[model samples]
Target: MSEVERPARGVSDLGELLATMRPELDPDAWVFATAAEPLAGAEVTVVEAEGVTSVLRKHDLPTAGDAPARMRVSPPFARITLQVHSDLEAVGLTAAVATALAAEGIPANVVAGFFHDHIFVPWPRASDALASVRALQRDAARAGDARG
Candidate 1:
C-alpha cells in the first residue's frame, strides 16, 4: 500500500494565502446551542464550565415538541469555509478577514481548524459576507500579480 504524502506545512505567506483562498459557504442554517450533553451530529463542539456548546445545522435539531427544555440556541448563522489550507502559524489572515467583514458591519465568529479557517456570520448577511471575502482574495491576487 502506498502512503499519501502531505505538504510539510500549509501556506503561511499572507499574500499567497489571501490570493488563493476560496471561500465556500454552506447553504444550510447552523446555530450555536448549549446543552447538558454534546449533540450527536454537531459539526463543532466545545465543553465549557457552563455546558456543552455545539454548532450544528438547524435541521438536525429536534422539533420544539420533542425538544429539551434546557436547550439554549442562538440565531441561525451561515458557515463559510476558506478552502485555502492555511498554516497554523499564519498571521494576519484572521485579522484581514475580520476587518473586511467588520467594515460591512457583519459579526464574524472565526474557528480555525488544523488546515482551514471557518467563519460564521448572520444567515441574512451570508451573501454579503461571501462577497466581502471574495473581494479580499481578488484584491490580494491583483496585488500579487502587480508585484510579479
Candidate 2:
C-alpha cells in the first residue's frame, strides 16, 4: 500500500513568509474606543498629531485621540491592535496575520501605516486572535530553523 503524505500546516519563518506573502491593507483604518468608561460615542480618528485630543465633533465616538508616533488600526473589528515594529511596512504583515486569523475562525480588519501593522478584532475574541498570531510567529521560526 502506498502511504499518503500530509500537507504542511501553518506558516514557518513568519517574518520571511510575511516578507513573501504580500498581504494587502484595508483603506479605512480606525477603531472607536469601545472599552473606555461611560462609552462616549466618538469616532476615534488616528490623526498624525502630537497628543490625544477630544474633538467635539458631531459624532458618537467618545475619544478622538492621536495615535502614537508609530501606530495603525484595522477597521470593522475595533477592539484589537497589532503593535508592530516601526520599520516594517503595513501591507505584507497585516495581510498575512489577517489571513492566519481567518483560518482560525477569527475575523480581523487590517490597517497599514508607514511603520507598523494593526489588527482590529472583536473584543471577545481578541485574546484568542492574538494567540493565533503568536503561534504563526513560532511556526515561522521553527520552519526557518529547519530550512537553515
- lDDT of each candidate versus the true structure: 0.95, 0.49
Could you say which candidate leads in TM-score? 1
Model 2, stretches more than 4 Å misplaced? 1-14, 17-60, 63-83, 86-91
Clashes of each: 0, 10
Tens-place lDDT digits, model 2, residues 1-148:
9998744333333466543332223333235332312233333333434534322122344334733332222233433444434343222565668788999899875544443456666655666776787777677667777877
Reference-based TM-score of each model: 0.91, 0.48
Q: Give the Å error, residue 81, model 2.
A: 4.3
Cα lDDT of model 1 by residue, 73-108, tens digit: 999999999999999999999999999999999999
What TM-score would you give candidate 1 relative to the actual structure?
0.91
Q: What local lDDT score does residue 17 receive in model 2, on the 0 to 100 scale? A: 53
